[model samples]
Target: MPTEDHQAFVNELVQEHGQRLRSFLARRLHGAGADLPDLVQEVYLRLLRIPDVQTIRSPRAYLFTVAIHVLHQHRLNLASSPEAVDIAEALPMLQARSGDNPAEQVEAWDRLEGFYEVLGELPPKTYAVFVLHRQYGYSREEIASQLGLSYAMVKKHLAQALVHCRRRLDAME
Candidate 1:
């Protein structure tokens, strides 16, 4: 049972904030072959199920927050699947592009994967805060609130994580 007012509100939200939402997802999912329109549709679908959509004070920011969550869930699902193929399979055919070197690109990806593996060796809370802030683009304040951590603690953890990542990357280099 959908109310006309609610439908109208959603429509208004789509019209005003749709592009920004899509662009946000576009940047986060740059190499994942994620369709912006499809992601936007999924966001709207989730919005429809939420009973308190109208109560949100900043719908645009809320929409981006929801979209980020959706993207995170999508990545988790992909990572969880044993049969999932590597994203390199979806890269554009660039044989004709003079500046493109598939070998180098693949090497870089492997290095990044190794970097993430090193990141995983960190304590769970430290890794979680680092991933939420660095990978998922959550602010320190937002991550602290979500994880029930003090802001100073989050900063300290991030600083430590960054130093560790730097050392690891340097060694790799």
Candidate 2:
């Protein structure tokens, strides 16, 4: 059950916006284009699923929308698996943007304080797990070995850490 023009339309999308979509994903994905091709294929698969491709007013936005969802799934996978998530990658995201002014500095400090306050509320081992990975740049395997904990335990701790961080950040906002 193949539409005769479906392949043609998919090709058009790639021909027109392929580079732009890849570039957008590259920037969002830590500037690594390793997964760029796979993500693009996924985008095409999604686009082809639409019953009518002609109905799309802005294919560029549609492509971006799918790409972002794909990126989100990638992040969620990272959140669950320490081997994929990098603390350095998370740091910039966590940092509060500050203007070049004393007032902005004060606000940033306040946000930092709130973040630390939330971290402090976590269970001791869970907090330690986060610090080991983020501050020490320890792999989850290394953290597990250092703490004499199981891999599953390390993953659980990371999940707990992420949930707590998101909850507090949302509340603060």
Candidate 3:
């Protein structure tokens, strides 16, 4: 395709299906709407790279197919990042152990209340990252994706949450 033609074709596709494409990606990503814009851009970039858009019989289907591929690649990239595992391992400090006796259970309950108080004091995003990862078993990368934060930011939030909880809980003892 000529340069002008290719641009026009790509622009037309974006104009027609951009909103639906974004909605599709947002749903597939499981509320990771933060990455929607980037993912949509990637899909269009891929579409532009196709040597012959004319060869496609079904443009809407083709567009969604490209979106699915982008989503798959995104998941693969997130899965291959190894740093999330290391940070996740360091989070064992946040896990509460089971109490074997009534006195210990009472102490555990007290500590749990203190922990909730500390969580409430956190900035909303930090608290979300901490709870989603620790309580809900989401990986750091997943939290980063869902929350639209960088991986380092997610790690920092988790660390801050941990430190704050520890200090506050210790004081409660």
In terms of TM-score, which candidate is strongest?
1
Summing lDDT over every window of 10 consecutive residues in candidate 3, give the lowest-scoring window.
85-94
| Candidate no. 3 TM-score | 0.47
Question: In model 2, which regions exceed 4 Å deviation?
Answer: 82-173
Candidate 1's displacement at residue 58, Å, is 1.2
Cα-based lDDT for every prediction? 0.64, 0.68, 0.68
Q: So what's the TM-score on candidate 1? A: 0.49
83-158 per-residue lDDT for model 1 (tens digits): 5421111111112222346566556445644554566456556666777777667899987887677999989988
Judged by whole-model lDDT over C-alpha atoms, candidate 2 comes out at 0.68
Residue 90, model 3: lDDT of 12
The residue pairs in collision within model 3 are none
Per-prediction TM-score = 0.49, 0.46, 0.47
Ranking of all predicted structures according to TM-score, beginning with the best and ending with the worst: 1, 3, 2
